[model samples]
Target: MKTKQEESATDFLKLVKNMKYFTKLKSDNSNGDLFNVTLKTASYNELNLMVSCLLKASICALKNDNSGYSSASESGIDVLLLLEMALQLLPDEEMQLLDEFHKNAIDRKAEQ
Candidate 1:
């Protein structure tokens, strides 16, 4: 039997997997050049750490008692760092495509 925390973590993983933003690949094949970005799933350890941190943050936030809370900035930075670790798991090719996409977005914004 799965513990409540484990169940919640599994549910969160399922939610993330089903989200198109995370799983979808961006591809545009024009001028005989193919630009493909592959989606990479987080490793078991990475997912566990991320879920644990997120759950702890949520639990702290929901505490109505006069107990102290973690600094918002610290929690936010932890989340960001976790996300960065997840992204770093992507393959080199995928990272390159992502960088290209980011650069294109920046260029577009600059044009406007």
Candidate 2:
């Protein structure tokens, strides 16, 4: 059986593939999704900078939430949801490392 990480990796790949088609579709706004356009047009360095900013934001969000894992805080859940989206922007190796870290965190929470 595939490990959870393995399944997650597979699912991530599928989502990336699906995003290609979604990107092709026209948005309701005439501007046509500025974020999507930026992602498509940005240089490698620009994209890297954007991802770094997102990581910083996620860290700040995570740090602001004080509630212990046993009792989920609204902010904690929001941070996790944001982190999930941020994970998609990361390179595979970094993504895997973060993914493992998150899994370990959840496992530790379950132990408490």
Candidate 3:
């Protein structure tokens, strides 16, 4: 039997996978050229790290208690940090695509 933490981790991973698939589908539907390049050259490890941070941030948001609450900025910062880490890991060619994605994310936040 898996421990509670392990089960939660597994569930989080599944959630992240589904989110990635949806994001990819949305990207493909919106911008075929960008989707094609991202699908072809994206780093799985970086994606995984980004998803993990997102999941954690989501959990924090949901668990807002009397002590304090998680703000959108907190989550956004975490994601940006992960993106920076990913950029460092990727080659110059791939970094451009990641930068585009990062800019899109920032734009979405500004719109919200």
**How many clashes in each candidate?**
0, 0, 0
TM-score of 2: 0.37
lDDT of each: 0.61, 0.68, 0.63
lDDT of 1 by residue, 1-112 (tens): 9999999999998888788455355556663464455644477566456656656655554452225455545445454555455455435785589899999999999999
| Candidate 1 error regions (>4 Å) | 1-42, 64-112
* Superior candidate under lDDT, 1 versus 3: 3
Q: What TM-score would each prediction reach against the true structure?
A: 0.24, 0.37, 0.25
RMSD of each: 17.1, 20.4, 17.6
26-108 in candidate 2: lDDT tens per residue? 45565755433224635656767777777787776666554353323554456666666666666688658989999999999
Give the higher-TM-score candidate: 1 or 3: 3
Weakest ten-residue segment in model 3 by summed lDDT: 33-42
TM-score of 3: 0.25
Candidate 3 lDDT, 28-67, residue by residue in tens:
5666664423434367676656656656754555455323
Ranked by lDDT, the better of candidates 2 and 3 is 2
Best lDDT goes to which candidate? Answer: 2
Clashes of 2: 0
lDDT of 2: 0.68
